[model samples]
Target: MKIAVIGTGGVGGYFGAKLAQAGNDVTFIARGQHLEAIRSNGLLVKSVNGDMHIPNAQVSDTITDITNADLVLTAVKAWQIKDIRNDIKQIIHEKSIVLPLQNGVMAADELAEVIPEKQVMGGLCRIFSLIEAPGVINHVGFKPEIVFGERNGVQTPEMEVLSQLFDNAGIACKASRDIEADVWKKFIFICTSALLAVTKTSYGELRELKETRQMMIALLNEIYAVSQKKGVKIKPDFIDKTIAVIDAVAYESTSSLTRDVWEGKPSEIDYQNGTVVKLAEKYGVDVPVNRFVYDCILPMELKARGKFNRQTS
Candidate 1:
């Protein structure tokens, strides 16, 4: 398979490496020091599952470097989806599949706004991984897996082929019956965890403290209510299920949004909890907890985006 990976972060680097390792034609699109490092020293993945390296990696800063790619993984931050839509479209042929391994629910729809809806698949990845350094990916926890499918719940031959290909590369992937609901299921955990940004608390401290834990539940319930109003087929006990997922993770863990906020980097705040608040309003559902979290993060988020003028204030 010919694969093009845009944004060579943890998700892209790791999965692209695996696909390349399995002898597929994989081109990684990256930039800056990361691109230089991958070009100079190849890509390295430090994984709990197992560490791997690919020397002489095929990497480029330009998307047009790859054309007619069989698959394109837009692994950039959720907010970056719209910005890269035209670039992604350049690399894919008509039959090429575009999978988004982002953290939020809007990736597919965002891509479909520009790219063909049939080419955009609803997808999400299950892995606690990040770029440790320029060209190094760190996989800390969870068995890495990808759940994706056609948004309309119809299976295609490409889906079957991709499933077998992932299996061949030793990647755990599933074709979902209801991709929207699956995306929302993952959203509950991530949206709740993103609150760590406002609280400046670790997963351990957030879930261990009785008061914070209750607040977390409130946030989860608000998201659940919003999801229900949106007609996402989430489970009734999803809050408990999400809590169980939180309990299983290492307490010291922090969400990507939290880490980005703490490091003063632009983040997916508008696409995660903020998205919840928007959807809630659109659906006439009250999501006070989500609204509070979104409001708390807005100042820093605006500053990161250079929309907040600190000196003038």
Candidate 2:
């Protein structure tokens, strides 16, 4: 398979390396020192499953340089999808599939609005990994699975072929019959955990405090209510299921959003919890918990991006 991995961050770097090691023609689209390091030293993945090194990595910062891709795995931050939509269009043919493996629920829809709907697939990934350095990705935890499918829950030949390709590469993957539900399931957990982590700054601390734990549950319930109002078929017990998943995570595990905020980098707060709040309003479902979390984090997020300015009169 010919694959183009846009945004060689943690998700892209790890999965792209696996596909490349399995003999797929994988092109990593990245920039700056990361791109230079991959070009010179190779792309490295330090994984709990096993470490992988692709020394002869095919990498480029320019999307136009990659003209032939069977599959395009867009792993950029949620806020970056719209910016790269046109750039991605230049590399894909009509038969190419674009799977967005970001943390938000609206990525596939956003991409579809910009690109061809027939080419966009709703997708999400389960992995706790990050770019530890320029050329290295650290897959610290989680089972690391990728779930994707056609937008409307219909199976297609392209989905079958893509599933087989992932299996061949020894990747834990699922072709979901209902990809939207899968995406929302992940969204519920991520938004709740991310907001709690943002406010508390530690997953351990967030989960330990009874008051915070209750707040986390309330946040999850709010997201569930909003998703239900939007007509997404989340399981009735999804809130309990998500809470259990959160409880099982490693004590010190923090979300990428929290890490980004703490490290003074731009994050996807507006796309995650903020999205829930927006949808809640649109659906007439009150999501005070999500709204409060989004409000608390907005100032910090703006500051991280240098958009916050204090006014003194």
Candidate 3:
């Protein structure tokens, strides 16, 4: 199948390379030095599974260059939804399944508002990928999974065909029945993890520090409450289960926001804690914990605009 990977960052770069390596007609839409490097050489995925290089790829920064795609994977950040959304109609085919692998519940809704004709499939991607450099993507660990389904869980030909393509690429993928539940479950963990470790400290520090550990628990609980209010059927004893997952891992696993803040990049607080806050006001569900997180990270918005207070020792 002909595929177009929009926003060739960590998620797009790694997954698109896999599909392309599997002999699919994959065109990566990218820009800047990264696009130049991919054009000169190819996209490189440095993963625990081993390095993968796709030489001689069809790539262009413009949407019209890669028009008529069979499947278009929307991999851009949530903040860029409005920026690149109008291009969807320019490139996407009628039969294409626009999979938004963004980390939030509003992905389908947000994209549907723009391109409702393009079949918007909700994808709750489970991967720990990070862009090591402009042309290099460092996929940490090996367990990368992509679960997607239509807004309604019908056995569509497009969904089935996409599943087979992923299988051909040797990726563990599936067509989920309740993708919203999956997204909510993943979002619960992510919101807690990101908010708890945003203070330039690792999860180990927060878990070891009694005060911060309690705060982490509080944050997790608040997210859980919001999830319940939003009518997402999380697993029973979900908090305990998630905490066990957290405890089983290395103590020093920090959040992406912490790393982004440290490296002076924009964080996804508005989509995360801000999501909960908006829902809290919508449902009249008091989420003090989520509200507190909103307050804590609101100051970081200035960081994106070169206005954050820098601490010096």
Candidate 4:
């Protein structure tokens, strides 16, 4: 299948290379130093799975250069979806499928606001990867996996085909039975763990310390409550499940949000915990824990975006 990978960072770079390696027609969309590096050196993936090089990678700074694509994997930051929706429209035809492998629940909704709702698929990815250099993707941890399906959880022949395509690329992937629940299930952990960005705690320290663990549970409960109010079907013991997942991770592990905040880079604060706070207010649900996390991070987020006036302080 012909594939267009938008935002060729870790998620897009790693997966797109796999697809391209498997002989799929893959066009990578990138800009700046990354684009130049790929053009000069192709895309190099240093992975725990196995390192691979795509010399002569088909790439473009412009999205429309692809002309057409069978699938568009949107791996941009959750906050960036809106900025590229119009560009995305330029490459897709009626049969195109758009899958968003962002960290939050709002990606599909954000894309669907401009693209056709029928073409957008809710999805999430499990991988610890980053741009180690301009053209180098570092897959440092986690066996990569992708779960996606139609927003309504209904299966389609197209879903099956996509699953097979992933399998052929040696990627571990599955079509979700309930994409909504799956996305929230991942969210419950990610949004809660984002607090570590503020506390500067590692996974080991987070679960070992009494105060931090309690705070983690409180944050998890608040997000779960918001999900319930929104009618996403998460199990009652999901908090325990989320905690177990956290405990099993490597001791020093941290979330993308945590790393972004610590590095003074723009983050998905608005889409993750911030989204919960907004939804809680909308649905009349109490999310004080989530509110606290979001509030604490807001200033750093604003400062990173050049929206905070530190001189005024």
Top candidate (lDDT):
4
TM-score, candidate 2, is: 0.97
lDDT of 3 at 74: 84
Residues 276-311 of candidate 1: C-alpha lDDT, one tens digit per residue: 999998999888888989998899889889999657
Give model 3's clash tally. 0
Better of 1 and 4 by lDDT: 4
> What global local distance difference test value does model 4 have?
0.92
Ranking by TM-score: 1, 2, 4, 3
Candidate 2 or 1, higher lDDT: 1
Indicate the worst ten consecutive residues by lDDT in candidate 4.
304-313
TM for every model, in the order presented, reads 0.98, 0.97, 0.92, 0.97
What are the per-residue Cα lDDT tens digits for candidate 3 across 14-39? 89999999999999988899899889
> Candidate 4's residue-wise lDDT over 199-284, tens digit each?
89988888899998998999999889899999999889989988898889889988778999999999999999999989999999
Evaluate model 3: give its TM-score. Answer: 0.92
TM-score (C-alpha) between model 1 and the true structure: 0.98
Q: In candidate 4, which residue ranges exceed 4 Å CA deviation?
A: 310-313
Candidate 4 total steric clashes:
0
Model 4 TM-score, 2 decimals:
0.97
Q: lDDT score, residue 287, model 4?
A: 84
Better of 1 and 4 by TM-score: 1
